[model samples]
Target: MAQLQLGPPPQQQQRPAQPGQPGQPQQLSPQAPRPPQQARPARPATPSDTPPSGQPDASRDQRRRALPGETVAPAPDETVIAPPRQRITNPTAVFSGLDKITGRIIAFDVAIDETVQFGALQVTPRVCYTRPPTETPQTTTFVEVDEVTLNGEVRRIYSGWMFAASPGLSGVEHAVYDVWLTDCKQSAPVIPGQAQSQPPATR
Candidate 1:
């Protein structure tokens, strides 16, 4: 049989302090390895953010500047002038007469200030003008027409300008006849033993 020895339930082994200062921290036990603390990442700058100076980029200013020895074009002339339109004047004005009763259409020429009879109407041209062949054909005449009554009485019917291109706007209009200007020239051809314009039979 052995003798039992129980002084104090065996005491934990203590580490002896090899300390230097008075308020120094003492080691308790092996500390658990701490997780490494990660560093915060820095933010990147954006293009939309304006700089402190508020000035435009140097690259853009260089593009706007003119290069040396560059040639510049001149501006075009602004004012434009046109030549005048040419016209031709004639001594005689030619006309076409329509007889609604006889269904006859006859073309005749009349000299300026001369009176010519067409059916019961007398035509007198005051002025006639035309354009050159190279230009547009515009035959215009200032004329007067008189109507003769059955009782031998004469009265003015119409008097104004007439355009050949537009016959409906002519100066002469009668119940049985219509006269429109056709052309303007120096003279008309003379027929053998016949006058260019037939005179009205003696009343």
Candidate 2:
């Protein structure tokens, strides 16, 4: 046995571990000193010029407003309105009768509530009306027609309104005589002995 020397062991050290030191390494403990910490870089501030999130920009608000002294008219209503129709009354209704077999056409006038004879038919006008001259001309008449058959039977043939503007639409289809309204007037020149109103026949 050799004599032991030194107050501290070479394999163990109480100091903190140092770099580039030779021999046995030193163990770190709570008493060891720490290195100084570096300061963190400052955070950049946000731009004040830009608008905040979730908001409309200034340019959009300008478009919503009208220009200076400019008139902004209100929106127009969607409903549409129409004018009332006006019609004028007349005293006489002028008509044209066509005889299919003879191909003869006769023009005549009958006063309201009076009947005129044409061939075997009696024509009576109830109403005669017309539109204003400034407006579209439309002459109309409500008339009744009776056909006297060979058996002395006065059968009702046609009873409806007749339009002067469209004669084809108002006529007796199968009868030999067809009468259509031509015009409505206040008075018509008298045709001497041409048309005579018949008295009511006794049953």
Q: Please name the candidate that would achieve the greatest lDDT relative to the true structure.
A: 2
Native-referenced Cα lDDT, model 1 = 0.80
Q: Which digits, one per residue and each the tens of the lDDT, describe model 1 over residues 120-196?
A: 98999999998888888898999999999999999999999999899888656578988888888877534446756
**Model-by-model lDDT, in order?**
0.80, 0.81
The clash count for each model shown is: 0, 0
> Candidate 2 on 1-203: residue-level lDDT in tens?
99787666666556556855897476565687676798998765343445568876454555468698876554232244657778999888998988999999999989999999899889999999998878888999999998988999988888999999899887566458888889988976477887889999999
**Candidate 1: lDDT of 33?**
62
TM-score for each candidate, following the candidate numbering: 0.55, 0.55
* Candidate 1 error regions (>4 Å): 1-76, 188-203
- What would the TM-score be for candidate 1 when compared with the true structure? 0.55
Model 1, total clashes: 0
